[model samples]
Target: MLSPEDVQKVATLARLKLSTEELQQVSRQLDGILDYVAVLNEVDVSNVEPMAHVADVANAFREDEVRASLPREESLSNAPKTDGKYFLVPQILETA
Candidate 1:
């Protein structure tokens, strides 16, 4: 069970301002949460192995293979604006 003072102290550490009513409300809520945790602590899981996931998972990647590249003119044909060899984009940053 968490006392009102304990709740108040936690609120202070978290930089929260609580009225008297709010402090009491939070204290009750904290006590209930602690009670639930205590119930969980009574469960026996000594035989269970720790698992990272509930379902089996595997990497699903396609085999890599080299392929012919698109010609520069064909690739740049649809660009709104481009240099002969590269895409021409608006400058968005300034250097000090």
Candidate 2:
């Protein structure tokens, strides 16, 4: 349980400006959330095993195979700008 003053302190740290009504509302909401978390903590799981995933899963791999690629000349021929073997771009750095 958090006091109203504690909620105010949290609001101040967050740089949030809340009215008196909003402060009260937020304080109640925060307390409710804390209470719900406390209930969750009361659950017994001593015999339960932790699992990495909820559903059964396995790696689906495909057979490795060689494939042909588009010709380099055809790939770069439509470029707005190119530097022979690669694409060219405007300078990113500013001159001093």
Candidate 3:
């Protein structure tokens, strides 16, 4: 079982703000989670093969076909704000 101090340390590391009651509750819950992991660690996997994932799958990406893009005026038509030739967005970075 995790101690109160240990629970407090973990909460601090995780940036959590907990009351005394919540700390006690979390300590018990964390102990249960650790105990469950200990049980899993005891399972034998000597015959099992290591894998990237449990399932075998591959991505099927479509080929890119470069063609004509939307006209500047058409693309800017739906924008909430636009300058004559381009999209007008709020300045995020200041110029040096």
Candidate 4:
């Protein structure tokens, strides 16, 4: 069972602000979750094979191929702001 203090600690780590009532409720919920996990821990899996995924999944990625790209003028045509040679974006940093 999770104590209120334990819930508070977890909330603090997660940077969550919970009221007293919420803390109590979350404590009970966490306790229940832990209890369910404990029950699952008791299941026999010694004969089961370990696997990354339940389904037989395989990567279906195509091989990368070199290709010509769109011209610079055409590429910059969709930009909200550009200086003909480059995309013009807001200056985010200032020299100290």
Candidate 5:
């Protein structure tokens, strides 16, 4: 069970300003959470393997392969600004 002082100390560390009523309410809530955790601690899981997730997970991406790409002219056709060979973006950095 968490005392009101314990909850107040945590609130102070977290920079939370709780009224006296709020402090008492939070203390009771935290104590209930701790009690639930204590109940969970009693469960036996010695044979269970630790895992990152419960479901079996696999890579969902398509296989990577070299493929044909759009021709340069077609790729550059939709650009708002472009030179003959490359896209022309506005200069953002000041040079030394």
Candidate 6:
């Protein structure tokens, strides 16, 4: 359970400017959320094993193989500008 003062401090840290009414509302809502978490903390889980994933899954993969690719000249021919083998574009920044 958080005090109203504690809620106000949190609001300040979060850069939120809440009116008195809104502060009260937010304090109550945060208290409710904390109570729910407290309830969850009381659950028994002694027999449960921790796991990263819930499903029983196996790795599915495909073999890597080389495939034919278009010739460099043909590929760059459609570009608006190119530097022989690669596409060219304007510089993003000026050197100092």
The TM-scores of all predictions, comma-separated, are 0.43, 0.42, 0.45, 0.46, 0.44, 0.43
Off by over 4 Å in 5: 44-96
Assess each prediction's global lDDT (C-alpha) against the native.
0.88, 0.90, 0.88, 0.89, 0.89, 0.89
The TM-score that candidate 4 achieves is 0.46
RMSD (Cα, Å) for all candidates, in order, is 11.9, 10.8, 7.9, 7.4, 11.4, 10.5
Off by over 4 Å in 3: 44-96
TM-score of 6: 0.43
Q: Residue 73: error of model 2 in Å?
A: 37
Candidates by TM-score, descending order: 4, 3, 5, 1, 6, 2
Candidate 4 global CA lDDT score:
0.89
40-78 per-residue lDDT for model 4 (tens digits): 777899888878876776987887998899999999999
**Candidate 1 vs candidate 2: which has greater TM-score?**
1
- Cα lDDT of model 6 by residue, 1-96, tens digit: 788899889999999999999999999999888888888678898998978786778786878888889999899989999988779999989999
lDDT of 2 at 52: 77
Tell me which residue pairs clash in candidate 4: none
- List of clashing residue pairs for candidate 2: none
Q: Model 1: C-alpha RMSD to truth?
A: 11.9
Residue 85 in candidate 4 has what lDDT? Answer: 86
In model 1, the clashing pairs are none
